[model samples]
Target: MFRPLELFIGLRYTRAKRRNHFISFISLVSMAGIALGVMALIVVISVMNGFDNELRTRILGMVSHATIAGVGESVRDWPEVIKKAEANPRVLGAAPYTEREAMLQGQRVAGALVRGILPEQEPKVSEVGKKMVAGELHDLVAGGFGIVLGKELAYKLGVDVGEKIVVYAPEIRATPVGAVPRLKSFTVVGIFEIGMEEFDSGLAIVHLADAQRLYQTDGPDGVRLKLDDMFKALGVARELAGDLGGLYRVRDWMQGHQNFFRAIAMEKRVMFMILSLIVAVAAFNLVSTLVMLVTDKQADIAILRTLGATPGSIMGVFMVQGVFVGVIGILIGVVSGVIMALNLEAVVKWIEHTFGVAFLSPDVYYISDLPSDMHWSDVGLIALLGFVFSLLATIYPAWRAARTEPAAALRYE
Candidate 1:
C-alpha cells in the first residue's frame, strides 16, 4: 500500500541530513530535553508512589482500618461486635482493643500510647504480632500484666523482654501520700518493630485484660477491624454503624490520617506541574527547529506546492517531523525511566555506600531507604502530555510554512 504523501515526506525530512548542522544539533537537544524531563518525572513520581505505599503498609498495617465502639467510650459487648463486624463481607478480621495515653518510665521517661490487645485475636486485626522482633503474641495472657514495647520505645527506655517498666496514667488516685498519678508496673514480654518511627517510639501493647484493668473498665474501648479493601473502610464503617444502630460509632483510617496523605497527593501534583514545564520547554525547541528547517527548505517547499501539494499536506509534513522527535524521546524516556524506577532502591544503596553518605535517616524519616513504585498509568499520562506538547509546538510554524507564497519563496531562493 502507498503511504500518504504528507507522512512520506514528513518522515524523510525527519531522517534527512540538514544543510545546517546547527539545526540537527537543535533537534537532538530538543529530543534530549524531552527525554530528561520525562525520565525525571517518572522517577520522582514512582518514588513518591513507593513512599505512599510503604507508609500504608508499615504504618496503617499496624493500625486498624476501622473501629467500632459504643457511644459510652467502651464496648462491653465487644465479642458480639466482633461477630457483627466479621459478618460483613468487607470485614477481614476484628479484635478488641483498649488504648490510653500514658508515660513509660524505665532508664528514661517517654510519652506512650498504651494499647490493650488480646494476644490470640490481635494478629487477626493488626500486623504488630507478625512484626514482633522478640517474644510471641500468645505470651500476653489475661491478668499476666505483660507489656509489649515498640522496638524504638524499648531502645529509648533501655528495656527488653522479661525486663520491667512503669506506666504512669494521667488519672489521679488517693495514695498514702495524698492524691498522686495512677501508676502500674509490668514486665515487658515482647518487642515489635513496625518500621515506623512514630509507632515504634510512641506505641506499646499489653493484654486486653491488663489494659481494661489499667483503664478501670470492665470491657474493651472498641473493636478494631481489618478490611479486605482498605479504601472501602469508610463506606463499610458507615454501613456497619447503620446496621448496628446509633449506640455504636464507627471510625475509619482516613478520618485520622487524611491530612497527611492529602499533603502527599498535593505535593505529587505540584511536582508533576513543575517538571512538566521542562517538557513544554523542550517541545518549544521543536518549533524553533522546524521553523529553521522551513527557512532552509523554502525553495523546496515552493517546488512541492507547484507540484500540486496542498497547504494541509505541507502542514502534515512538519507535524509528522515534530511527532518523530517526540516519539523517539518518549520511547527512550519510558524504557530508561522504568528501569531506573525498578532498581532505584539498589541504586540508592550503592550511591550511599560509594559516597559514604546517608540519604535518609530512620530517626528523621518514617523509613530509612528510598523506594520506587512505577505505575504504567502514570507513564501513559506522561507520554500523552509530552506528545501533546510536541504536537502543539509544531502548529504555528507548520501553519506558517503551509501559508508560504510559492512564487515569492522561489523568487527569494
Candidate 2:
C-alpha cells in the first residue's frame, strides 16, 4: 500500500507539542472531563442497582409477596385458600392472615394495621418468626388471647411483653349490651424489629384463631402467599386468582411499592442523561484542541497537499489520534470505576469506622451503608458513545487541515 504524505504529517502534528500552551491545557481538560463522566456514570448506576437489590431482599423479607382474599370484605374459607396456594410450584410459603385498621388505646394512642397470623405457618412465610428481639416463636404458638407488637410501636404505647393493650374497632354485634364501638384487650407476648420505620410504627400481629373470633369471621380473612420470586408477584397473583375464580380476590406487593420503584427508575434515567452532558463537553473539547492544532500546522498541511495527499486520508489521521486519546482515557476510568464500585460498601464502612463518621444514616434513608452493583451493559454503552463522540469531534478540524491551500500557506515561508 502506498503511504500518503498528508497522513504522515497529520500523525506528526498530533505528537508534536503546539506553541499555544492553552490548546495543550484544553486537551488535558478534555481527557479529565471524559474520565470523570465515565466514572460518575458507573458509580451512580451501580448504587441505584444496589438500592433495588436491597429493597427486594430486606423489605420483601418482612412483607407477603401476594395475598388472596374474598372479593367482599373478607374470605370465609381462608384456610382452604392457603392450602390451594401452597400447591402452586412457585409458592414457597402460605399462611392465613387477617388485617384490620384499628386504634390502639394507651398512653400514646396510635393507629395501626393489626394482622393475625398462625404461629407455625409464620416461619414459612414472614421472617418475623426469626426476628424476635424480646421473645420466642413458641410464645406466639401457644394459643392464648395474646399478641405481639413491633418494637417501635411498643415503645410509643409504653407497653412491654406481658403488658396489656386495648385495640378498639367498630363492628356490628348482636349482644345483650348492644354493640356500638367494640374494644378488645390482649397481653403482649413478643416484640420484633425488621429495621424499617413503617413496619415498626404501624404493624401488630396476633394469633389466627383468636383474631378470627374477634372479627367474627368463619375463617381467615385472607391467605398471604410468599413466592419463590418476589418480582413475579403480580403475574403469579393474577394467575392464581384466575384459577380460583370468584371465590377470592388476589393482591400483590407490587401495588405497595409501585411508586417507590417508579421513582428510582425515573431518577436513574434523569441522572444518566445529566451526567452524559459531561462526556459531551469533553468530546467538544477534543474539537477545540484539534481545531487549534490545524491552525498551528497550516504550513505542514499545505506542504503535504503539494506532495499529493488526499483530503480523506487527512481526515482519517486526525480521527485516529483523537480516538487514541479517548480510548486510553476511557479504559483507565472504566477499570478504576469498576474496582471501586465492587468494593464501595467495605471501603465506606472502613472510612466510617476509622473516623467515627457515617456516610449515610439508616434513619435518614432506606439503608445505612453505601452499595454498588456493576452492570456490563452500561460499560459497553459508555465506551461506544465515547468513541462516536470522539470521531465526531475530529470532523471540523480534520476538514480544516485537508482544505489548507499550498500556495497561500507557503507564500510567507
Candidate 3:
C-alpha cells in the first residue's frame, strides 16, 4: 500500500542527513530522555502502589476494618453488639477486643500492646489465627494465663514458647511500703508473624478473660467489625452505629490512620508531577530541533509550496515526524518500565545480596523488602502526555516553514 505524501516525506526527512551532525545528535538525545523519564515514572509509581497494597493487607489482617465501642471505656454488652454489627450486609464478622499497653520483662525488656481475643471468634474478624507460625490460638484458654507474642516481640524479649515473662501493667497495686505497678507473669504459648514490623515487634495476644482481668474490666473495650469492602468502612460503621443507637459509637481504620495513607497519596501525586517534567522537557526539546530543520529545508519547503502543497500539509509533515519520534520513545519506555516493575523485587533482593546491603529493615520501615506493581493505565497516561507535548512542539517551527516565500527562497539560487 502507498503511504500518504506527508508520512512518506516526514519519515524521509527524519532519515536524511542534515548539514549539521549536532542536530541529529540532539534529536537522539531528546528521544532517549523521554524514554528514560517514562521508565523511571513507571518503576517509581509501581513501587509506591505495591507498598500501599502490602500495608493495607498486613494492617487489616491484624487491625479491624471498623470498631463499635461505647462512650465510656468498656462496652458492657459486646456480645449483643457483635451480633447486631454483623447483621449489616456490608459487615462480614464481628468480635470483641480489648487492648492495653504494658511492659514485658524477660531476658530483655520491651514495650508491648496487649490485645484480648477469643480464639474461636478472632478467625472470623482477623487473620491472626492463620498467621501463627507455632502453636494454636485456641491453646489460650480463658483462665489459663497464657499469651501469644508476635515473632519480633518474642525475639526482642529473647523468649520462646513455654517461657515465662512478666508483664507490668500501668495499674497500681497498694503495697506496705508504697503503691507499685501491678505485675503478673504469664507463659508464652504461641508465636505469630504478620510481616508488618510495627505489629510484629509491639503486639501480643491473650485470652479475652485474661485481658479483662488484667485491665480490671468486666467486658471488652470494643467490638471489631470485618467488612466485605474495607474502603466502605466509614459509611458502614456510621450505619451500624445509627442502627445500634445508645452509647454505641463507630470508628473505622481510615479515621484512625488517614494521615498516613494521605501522606503516601500526596507523595505519589508529587512524584508523578515531578517525573512528568522530565518528559515535558524532552518533548519541548523537539521545538529547537524542528526549528533548525525548517531553516535547513527552506528550499525544499518553498519548492513544495510551489508544487501546490498547502500550509496545513507542511504542518502535518513536521507533526507526523515529531509524533513518530515520541511514539517510538514511549513504546521503548513502556516495555522497559513494565519489565523493571514486574521484577523489581527480585532485582532489589539481588542487589542487596551482592552488595551486602539492606534496602528496608524491620527495625526501621514496617516491611523488610521492596515491592513493585505495574498498572497499564499509568503507562497509557504517560504515553498520551509525551505524545501530546511532542505534537505541540512541532507547531511553531512548522508554521514558520509553511510561510516561506518561493520567490525569496529561489532568489539566492
Which of the numbered candidates is closest to the native, going by highest TM-score? 1
Off by over 4 Å in 3: 1-8, 15-22, 173-178, 349-366
For residue 314, model 2's alpha carbon misses the true position, in angstroms, by 1.7
Candidate 1 collision pairs:
none
lDDT of each: 0.90, 0.79, 0.88
Worst 10 residues of 1 by lDDT: 361-370
Question: Considering TM-score, which of the candidate structures 1 and 2 is the better prediction for this target?
Answer: 1
The 10-residue segment with the lowest total lDDT in model 3: 361-370
* TM-score ranking of the models: 1, 3, 2
Model 1's lDDT to the true fold? Answer: 0.90
Candidate 3, residues 121-239: lDDT per residue as tens digits?
99888999998998889999988989999999999999999999998988998899999998888999999999887788999999999998888888898999899999999999889
| CA RMSD per model (angstroms) | 1.6, 2.8, 2.6
Q: Which residue pairs in candidate 3 collide?
A: none
After the best TM-score superposition of candidate 3, give how far the Cα of residue 12 lies from its true spot, in angstroms. 4.3
Ranking by lDDT: 1, 3, 2
Please report the TM-score between candidate 2 and the true structure: 0.89
